[model samples]
Target: MKAEILYEAISEINPKYIEEADMRVITKINPWKRFLVAAACLILCISLSIPALAATDNSFAYELLYTVSPELAQNLKPVRETCEDDGIKMEVVAASIEGDTVNILLAMQDMTGNRITASSDLMDSYSIHMPYDQTACCQLEKYDSETGIALWSITIDQAESKLKPGDKITFSVSEILSQKEHTEIKLDSIDVSNIIEATEFTVDPQIRGGAGNFDEDSMECKRLLLPEENGYKLCDGVILTGTGMVDGKLHIQCKYDDILNTDNHGYIYLKNSSGEVDEYYSSISFWADNKTDSYEEYIFDIPYDELAEFEIWGEFWTCNNAPIQGEWQVTFAISE
Candidate 1:
């Protein structure tokens, strides 16, 4: 079957149901025979009730906000505005204004049966304008292949003087580009020379920690206090405390002696044994609740078996992506 024909069949079903069908189809057929199996699965899924699938609302923003802060979810306002052109649809699902920040959830779909997504590159292709002068961050939260739809979360930090309560901000997009025209840079082209500096370190295997709690008794925790010469300082006073594997994920912690400095920020990257970069997720911040020493933790989703063969790299940069002058790499190795 042609790719477009297969996509059309898949698009008839709901995105959520397509996930289970995708898994079953993948497991049942060989890699070369995936298209045939996908077509068969799509036919089976379409026979079911379309209204039942439509009843389930799988909004990524709804789930994320509810999970993190229910109060924020309660105050969210729906945005019924949508823009469509060139076989592409952009829907402004909802928006929430909290203090100095306004969060907007957008859903984009490719109606041309293409497997394109609202990736960062695609977002960069368009210009988003708000009512006020603000700094914005856009993250592609989720993508549904079945429907060729992608969900995005955009947060805008408005100046205190510019934004007030009961103010509705109007957002507009311009210069939208086709996804096919976007050129993706290969991973090999990433130049890291002088961008980061790294040193090798090991974590003892006997140490362990429960969910959300660090094992203080573990040797890993003790090593967090390594002397200045052995440890890497993320900034002038921010120290890379320790590295460890917690619950099959690579965990690295840092101590920020100077939390008041807003300019201090950094990022952590992972490289596998093959030199290819691995995708990892982390949340780093400068604030700590009622603690004398503020800390930041980076956790990479890596399997235990592959953790031993991986290396961790750290880079100190301003939040705006400006390079901080210094060597900033800390490699990791698991010691038996």
Candidate 2:
């Protein structure tokens, strides 16, 4: 009797706690005496629909932003994510506007990738391609026209991390007022992409330089002969330019001729911004040190910039007049 009484009491309490609304009651809400029921229902429906619409809008905007290149990461560098996804790319070219003015664009593949694609008008604006590293703080140091110095550095924060293979990387670029800093709005795009790998050029100074027009003419290597089409290769001699405000080391790597061996000595020089030839353009010698191949090494520091060219040479003599081949390579880096 006691247990039965407790069970009856619990049933009455559970009913009281139940929500008062049910499906049958909703259908029989006394339609003839309709009150504020329909209005309340309409308001509830609107509230729920708004968030759905906003979510869709946000999704579309993010998609568009990912296709764009950030102007900040100077260079055609898009925020590439190659590990999981292929990269979205844009080619930037220069278009002369007026005197010192130029127009930069975000373009699609024209003569390179596909056969039918024409000059894509993806985006053309009053901008310049500031090719930069998408990695944060990675500023591309444009060579100083006047100084032979390339003392540029960027400190990537902890947030932007070291990359691994097949990782997705996002790049964000912002506006540059103008060439005359703060002149006009330039760009504000965030390019999304991934890099499968990076291609590097570890210069081989000796064989990498232009086949100087000095083949049979003079001692000093010619200035700006042309970018080597065949990459670094041993030749009769070499002619090329160096970079820096002060003399930096230049390394020439070549296969050591074992038989008779070879020897020649030379020096490098520079032409200053004033168009005057100088031994030291920017505290660095416009230098040349040509000599017969003793063993085979790389690097002879010199001061040079775009404005000033280099004409370095070894003793106007020839050694084992054969091409320096093998895994010979060159390396040029700043010391100061």
Best by lDDT: 1
Please give the distance, in angstroms, between residue 92's alpha carbon in candidate 1 and its true position after superposition. Answer: 0.6
Candidate 1 residue spans exceeding 4 A from truth: 1-75, 118-120, 165-168, 174-336
Highest TM-score: which candidate? 1
lDDT of 1 by residue, 162-261 (tens): 4444443434343232231211122232232312222433333222222223444643343332223345555454566655555445656665443232
Please provide, for model 2 over 112-230, each residue's C-alpha lDDT reduced to its tens digit, 9 standing for 90 to 100.
Answer: 22211221111111111111122112221222223211111122212222222222212122211111100111111111121112122222224322221223122222221222233
Worst 10 residues of 1 by lDDT: 327-336
Report lDDT (Cα) of residue 20, candidate 2: 37
TM-score for each model: 0.35, 0.16
Off by over 4 Å in 2: 1-260, 272-316, 321-336
Each candidate: what lDDT? 0.43, 0.22
Candidate 1 similarity to native, TM-score: 0.35
